[model samples]
Target: MPATDLVTAELTLTGRITTASNATFLGSIGDVAVVYKPIAGESPLWDFPRGTLALREVAAYQVSQVFGWNVVPHTWLRDGPFGEGMVQLWQEQDPAQSAVNLVATDHVPEVGWKHVLEGQDESGQMVALIHEDTPALRRMAVFDVVVNNADRKGDHILAMTDGHRHGVDHGLTFHRDHKLRSVLWGWLGDALTVEELEGIDRVSEGLNGGLGRDLAELLSAEEIGSLAVRCDRLRLSERFPAPSGEMSAVPWPLF
Candidate 1:
């Protein structure tokens, strides 16, 4: 669908997403479906400034566009039923496909996936956290690093039937501090491919041009500067970074 169609079309709230920490709704405009999160529905966050979650989501999409990876679905800010908020085109994911999974520790696949960690389930069975080692998902992991995403849970990744991995719920991102909690740690310590570095380069260079100008509307100077720093750091390291800071490397209730 054209970008303007979603932006201009009439937005109607069809259902509430009760599970989201912030107010979220499933909505539609004619035939186009979308996910909506109004700014007023945002809860106060200790680390992040209040009422900016929607903006950060839009910023993540902005960076995704620069990467040309479509890691985040097309997202933007607009006036909705409640007030101004973030709106993103809804993508129906394939139920059978999953980029990340919690599987029996003994049954962990020997190939096609990367092991993250092992822990016990609610029932006391040992399970391993793993994600598919595909280019599509790896691209998302790299994007998460560049954005300094603070939350990268498994449920946030949508596995499309055509092999595309779409990541959602990007409110906790682009912090001036290093709060990169995520479940995509499978590639930790791995050297970045040439293409991956090129993506980072594009974002870093764009910071001086159009992309940077676009982000200025949504982020503070410190946040935008932090974004540039992340890009340069990633490029220099040439590999996935290990978790740093006092924050846990992975999010709670990971899925």
Candidate 2:
């Protein structure tokens, strides 16, 4: 479908996604399915700016477009059934596949995967969090760092049948603080690849032009400046940063 149609078509609500922290709905703009989060339905947060999550979501998509990694799905803000909100093209991920998983500590895959951490499950069984050590997932980890994503629980990652990995639910992003929390820590401290460096370069160069102008509409000046700073640090350090400071390294309820 043409992108213009998505913006102009009437959005009809088909169902509700009960698990979302804020109000989220499954709907369609004609035949194209979409996920919608109304700004009015946004819950208050202690740190993030009030009622700005929808903007941040669209901003995340803008950043992803500049990166050319498709880390995030196509996202935009428009008026919906509940008024103004963020609307995104819904992606139907492969049902039988999972990019991240939990397994018994001893049975963790010795190849093609990376172990993140170990803990006891609800039933008291020892288990480990692990994810596929694929290039796609690696790009997502890098994307999370660039966006300062604050909530990267396991379920946020969608595994596509074609082997692509898509990261979703980007409402908590573009903070001017080090708020990154993710399940993609499998590549911590790894050296950045040439292609990865190039992607960062694209974002850096774009910041002074169209990308910068677009973000100015969705994020505060401080938040946009912090994004540039993160890009510079990523380029200079040339490695995945280990979680540090007083902030928790990972999100709670992992999944």
Q: What lDDT does each candidate get?
A: 0.94, 0.94
For model 1, how does the per-residue alpha-carbon lDDT over 1-255 read when each residue is reduced to its tens digit? Answer: 677777887899999999999999999977889999999999999999999999999999999999989999989999999999999999999999989999999989999999999999999999999999999999999999999988999999999999999999999999999989899999999999999999999999899999999999999999999999999999999999998877689999899
- Colliding pairs, model 2: none
**Which regions in candidate 2 have their CA more than 4 angstroms from the true location?**
none
Model 1, residue 197: C-alpha shift (Å): 0.4
Per-residue CA lDDT of model 2 for 1-255, tens digit only, reads 789989998999999999999999999999999999999999999999899999999999999999999989999999999999999999999999999899999999999999999999999999999999999999899989999999999899999999999999999999998999998899889999998999999999999999999999999999999999999999999999999779888888799
Q: What is the RMSD, in Å, between candidate 2 and the native fold over all Cα?
A: 0.7
Highest TM-score model number: 2
Q: What is the TM-score of each candidate against the true structure?
A: 0.98, 0.99
TM-score for predicted model 2 compared with the true structure: 0.99
Give the CA lDDT, 0 to 100, for residue 51 in model 2: 95
